[model samples]
Target: MGARHEERRRQIAEALLAIIDLHGLDAVSLRDVAARAEVSLGAVQHYFRSKDEMLLFALDYISERGTERVRRSLGQGEQPPRAVLRDILAELVPADDQRRAELRIATAFTARSLVSPKLADHLRAGYDSLYDVLVLLIRHAQEADEMPAGLDPERTAAALFALAEGLGMQVLIGHRNPRTALAILDEHLDRLSTTAS
Candidate 1:
């Protein structure tokens, strides 16, 4: 795609994400996205054949953005094991406006994914990618003797992934205070570092 076309699609996708963040997925329509994006309905339709297409594009866009941010924070093999885990888990929390906005879409899309297999696939892809990275990180920590001997990387990664997702939901719904959620995350990381050797 040309630069102009890519920019237009990104603009539309960002608008779609904003709408989902503000009014829930049910409020999403081509007109709403176009208005939010400050583009015309014809422009939205020009890029997305339908709402699902638009949503998938937005999910992919947000996932890439979220992944990039985490990678950047973790840096290139320099961060300590505990800090790496902390950064990954902390990124899942809605600590700031951008994370809160992204969490809104993630929460809404998770519900929609229950009945939409295509959406579920995209969601699963994002989660699985993160899980794989977490597994690798845990394994590295094991090789460095940070985690306990004989600890299972995949199992631990899965648990941490589940914990992060659950923490995000709890924080988003205000069921759990953000600080408390982060405290719980830190506690878990501390446990990881001090597990019986």
Candidate 2:
């Protein structure tokens, strides 16, 4: 029963992501998720008391995996400031189908978070953690004089995060080309470098 419960929960999470992927957050409901997962509504209720809770869980799950990826990237090879910066930044961009799906789901959840405390807290935690990574990269750049010392690490980190998320949304919505999104990022980074210097 325990294993079955666990499996049902996994299915529920997968279903939620798929629903968000297809119809966005507004279209997701416990019934929709249950139908998508091929599970009874009661089974989903057993795992998550509400759609909000399930959404939060999915968000946290995505954030945990993303953090691990960023950590692993930073741990590998050379580790030069610029190289690390680019690599870290690259992870945030939705360069592949899987990442694009995640981005789409994240956007849907964020929009739902406006009035839901459960979703808002999850969104806040994810954003804060991702922002911390950006802060670390910006500080590394500062130490190497790749970025200016006087720049506010907080603001700079926020700016970089904004660029990634904004571009991510554009890419997810099919409104922006990946190459052009990258070019936008490069141009933004170039401006930062000049300002930092």
Q: What are the Cα lDDT values of the candidates? A: 0.82, 0.78
Residue-wise C-alpha lDDT for candidate 1, range 1-197, written one tens digit per residue: 89998998889888888788778788688998889899999999987777567767776787778778878987787887757877887889888788888888777777778989988898888888888889888888888887876677888888888898799888988899888899998888778778774
Best by TM-score: 1
Q: Which RMSD values do the candidates have, in order? A: 2.2, 3.5
Model 2 pairs in collision: none
Error of 2 at 117 (Å): 2.7
* Model 2 misplaced stretches (Cα beyond 4 Å): 1-12, 23-46, 72-78, 194-197
Clashes of each: 0, 0
Weakest lDDT window of 10 consecutive positions for candidate 1? 50-59
